[model samples]
Target: MDTDALSPLLSALRDAVLDGDARGAASATERALGQGVDPQRLVDGALIPAMDEAGRRFENGEFFVPELLVSARALKASQAIVTPLLAQRGGVVARGRVAIGTVKGDMHDIGKNLVVALLQGGGFDVVDLGTDVPPTRFVSAVTNDRVDIVGLSALLTTTMLQMKATLKAMETAGVRGSVKVIVGGAPVTQRFADEIGADGYADNAAAALALARRLMASGA
Candidate 1:
């Protein structure tokens, strides 16, 4: 493997993802692989860092939903090419597992989807339960899927009540203590999270990712 060729390919992959160019990302990923770049290196060195930078930009108000959505698309494209290879080689190890969804009665998923992408990029295995998810589903994900964290999203003030309901369900099912619960959405507040006995709250996707990592570090 020529070090000179490898560095350029990796840089191309990173640039494509940061620019939200999905096709360019995939093409660059494939070229890098063909040139004998390590799959793990692609994931750790290019994909993860690019997403981290994207998250940073979003946190700093330099990017918004449109930018994040496209960057996530590019990351997914690159991951589609490299993830399977990494899996076969046992080179990928999840930092943790998270189950996330929009609480019942809420059809909104834009924020939830952004959190999922950022969490995945941050090396956690995320289970996206989509929109309008009920308490039972959250319970089942905890009891059966064994996720380390459960994220509840509610874009509407009305649907926010479902976060508390979900927490109650977890307690009743004997899974509440086993996982950390985080809440967020346009209408959610840290006070609401505390009132509902949640483990944490985040205002946006970047903060959510940081909250998750902190939770994992503290053994939640």
Candidate 2:
């Protein structure tokens, strides 16, 4: 597809996602592909950029939960189509490997999901451990997955403490130095991350991506 024709379709896909029209987003994505648009173009030009806008809006308070959720859902819908293409192209070559999880006792997933999307968009192979993950599971993922980075999420103040304990467990397992550790949540802060010996801390999903890239580049 010519850039002119592709640009409008890509914009449409972004609008559909931002408008919370999941079906429209899916249809638009498929239509773009059918029109000979590059799958990578769809991802890089539309979905990732749309999510970046959503993240910015969220940080600026221009978007609320409903808005962000709609955008995320739309991105997921588009990803459903693009992921297979990427896999066929050799699994969307990643910059590095990462393991992510919501710390033990925290069943929340929204923050974790956003982090995953941001990381994947930034070209990382991320293994999501889902919610309520124990410290040992994190250690095992690091050891078995040979991940370069570990990310922990905890939305509740009580569960945020688990992030530190998980770090301690990683230390005990002698894998703390093997992988960089990052922590975030509604209650988490850079100070807390520093106190707990985290390699980095992000205030939001975009910052998370930037931090992950920086850490990985530094050979952390």
Candidate 3:
């Protein structure tokens, strides 16, 4: 575990993720763990940076959905190894808990799925509610899962109204103030988010991760 030896393994893991080499990423993680590298270090130093780079590439249009998903799969490969060790040692501290879903009446989930992967890579414990999710289901996630943030997604103008309805459901459940709400989708806008009283909005997966981090930092 000397500095020189540690540096290369970390680099290998990072490169594997950025290159979308899931098998290599997993093998690197295993080798690093066997070499006595701290699991948390692997996560914070290699995995996080790799995902951040992937997100950057995505935002710059240098990476598409396929590329992003591949990178996420690589991260997942590493995390599969690291997570259990962290759990055993009580070393992993999740940034936050998030519940994400497409609002009711909108079956589109491409954007939501992308955001879900990025959020997971960003170190948030995400509960993916899939597409055409009911507002009541979101409310249940907030109350039962004790999630810190709720992400509502809609690809249609018609379905966007469901986002507002979802918010209203949270209000009715008296948990509106307890959790921060973020909205996004192809047709979603800042003005629409403002009108719906969302805490934040993001146009893409990278922005969603950034917005989630900001919301956590601001205690929103």
RMSD of each: 7.0, 5.4, 7.0
Scored by Cα lDDT, where does model 1 land? 0.86
- Per-residue alpha-carbon lDDT of candidate 3 for residues 1-220, written as tens digits (9 for 90 to 100): 7889899999999999999999999999999989899877887679878877887898899999899888888888887777655445322578899999999998766457667766876788889999899999999999999999999999788999999999999999999999999999978999999998999999977789899999999986
Prediction-by-prediction clash tally: 0, 0, 0
Ranking by lDDT: 3, 1, 2
lDDT for 89 (candidate 2): 40
On residues 110-197, what C-alpha lDDT tens digit does candidate 1 reach at each position? 4576677668767788899999999999999998898999999998889999999999999999999999999999789999999999
TM-score, cand. 2 vs. native: 0.63
Task: Report how far residue 191 has shifted in candidate 3, in Å.
Answer: 0.4
Best by TM-score: 2
Model 2's lDDT to the true fold?
A: 0.86
The true-versus-predicted C-alpha distance at residue 177 of model 2, in Å, is: 0.9
- Flag clash pairs in model 1: none
**All candidates' lDDT scores?**
0.86, 0.86, 0.87
* Weakest lDDT window of 10 consecutive positions for candidate 2: 83-92
